[model samples]
Target: MTTPLTPHITTPITADLLRGALDLEQTAHGVLPHRLPARARAQCADGQLAMAESQPSGVRLVFRTRATAVELETLPTKRVYVGAPPRPDGVYDLLVDGRPAGSATVTGGSTLTVDMTTGTAEHRPGPPGTLRFTGLSAGVKDIEIWLPHNETTELVALRTDAPVGPVPDRGRKVWLHHGSSISQGSDAASPTTTWPALAASLAGVELINLGLGGGALLDPFTARALRDTPADLISLKIGINLVNTDLMRLRAFTPAVHGFLDTLREGHPTTPILVVSPILCPIHEDTPGPSAPDFSDLSDPGDPSDLSAGRLRFRAAGDPAERATGKLTLNVIRDELARLVEQRSADDPNLRHLDGRELYGEADFAELPLPDRLHPDAAAHRRIGERFAALAFTAGGAFAPEAA
Candidate 1:
């Protein structure tokens, strides 16, 4: 227990307390978390990748402290699409001894405004904000402060009423997962509530989430980053991003997946690697995409007020016949992934494949629909998380400890 006489401690936020991020950069205000290291970032200059990596989806600060009160200062850069509905403020979740304790949101921070039609963006600076939690339990215990999953956060400083230190490692197996926006926690209520986070908690494995939003196009740099990171278990959720982004044809995607897996095997030859295909998205299951925002329901000369009213939605716009030309759809990609895994598993027994639809299948979709015709809502996140844990982490499952 910390006594009133104990002097307040101010600790510089460093890598020791951070989990899930691959790299950290010293910024003018504080430390900025990056999903990819500087070396990986240097190899590619895609704006989408830059934005997705900067948002700390699964990153959290973990430590043990007796402090009754704690304060965190941060500079969060929120993204605002021009003429689109304003996004809700990102929430910060706090946990004590692995249980939910409290949550908060900062009032003011920077904003990055984007004109999607013009493909231009602008930065607007705002003041740094503070988040404080008080009247916590007195005994020394583990504390986890999960950063906003959707916002680009720059951690400034941490202050506590008592001394703080990094929690000793519990020797849990590390699970490295990479995927698209859904895995990046697009509609999850908070960072810890994301499916991967939930599954990690249930499975009792440390997590390193590389689920970049629009950036999961199987870029070589990301493959290199995955190849170098240490992990006992690895999973890649592929397909949807490639299909929606219209980034590649079937020919290119098949080779890309092989190359990506080849790179990862270079570092972990026998580590358990699970390749998952895309979940059932009604709009994109048969129709090809580059999906675009849908505004037809709004009045003609569409009301900007309606835009800000949170009625934004997306629709798959590509023709279904394009599949004949090698353009991929969700169904086509899933079949290809299954075939690829079946072919490769003959020799690489450590490699396995899971159908994503099993995680969120037709029945599940009918019950809990995707709000934006893309990302799953909160309830769906829970369903998917629970299903994933039971399917992959249970006894004799591909990700089971003994399987490794």
Candidate 2:
């Protein structure tokens, strides 16, 4: 540890201290964690993918220390959309000795102003802020600071009342998952509360979440990234992003999915890879996507500040007739993914197909309707996580120890 920075010892943030990120880029201010590697990033220039990969959904700082109090210095980029209701400050969850403890948020750092209507964004730099956690039981314990799932954060420093060091890996399997915003934690309460995080917790596995919001298009670079990642179990939550973006049709979609799986298979021939279709999204279930924000629900359009009065909603604008022209819908993609998985599994026994609806289907929607008709709410995240654990981590399941 470096010399005391005032009353606490400053532990230099290093790659060894980070979990769930694929690469760490040293910046002038701090170390920036990235879900995609440098080579993969260079291969694609999509802005949404760039921002999503940098937000560190499943990333966290892990270490061992005896400190009763700790402070994390970070440079976080908080996204703000013009004319929309104010978003809550990014949350950093604390875990001590493998249990929920406390949470904090950095007050200020940088701002990313976005014009959602125009699909453009601007970044304004600011000084770093600190996240402080005080009062803990005495003696040594493992510590984890889960980064904000929605904020792009740069790790600056870790200061504690006592010395800190990286903890030894506990030899748990690592599960790598990639999906859309719902998986990126669109409206989840906190970083650790996201469905994937919760599922990983329940399943007792380390997690590497690449659930990029609006970034799960079947891109070659992303396939390469997934191929390079080392994982014991892998899953691709396909269909939602493809439908929402309307980037491809049946002719292209079929081969792209195959190529993506082929790339991953190249890396780990026998790794259990689960192909999950889109969850129960009623709007896009049969009707196609290219979903757009539906501000029509607003009681007072003039007073955009009342956005909270009515939740932000989305509507599928694609014509059902387009489905005849090879346009993809959630239901259509589900059928294709299922058929593809069944055919591929004949030769690749480790591969499996899971209907996303099984995790959150019609009954689930009745119990916990998606708040925005797009993303799952916190309760839904918990339900999906619990259900996934029961289905995938139980005996004879794809991720089960014996099954592997």
lDDT of 1 by residue, 296-378 (tens): 55674454324556656788989999999999999999999999999989989999999999999899888998877899998
Candidate 2 lDDT at 277 equals 92
> What TM-score would candidate 2 get against the native?
0.95
Best by lDDT: 1
Model 1 TM-score on a 0 to 1 scale: 0.96
User: Which regions in candidate 2 have their CA more than 4 angstroms from the true location?
Assistant: 1-7, 297-310
Q: How far is candidate 2 from the true structure (C-alpha RMSD, Å)?
A: 2.9
State the displacement of the C-alpha of residue 345, model 1, in Å, after optimal TM-score superposition: 0.8
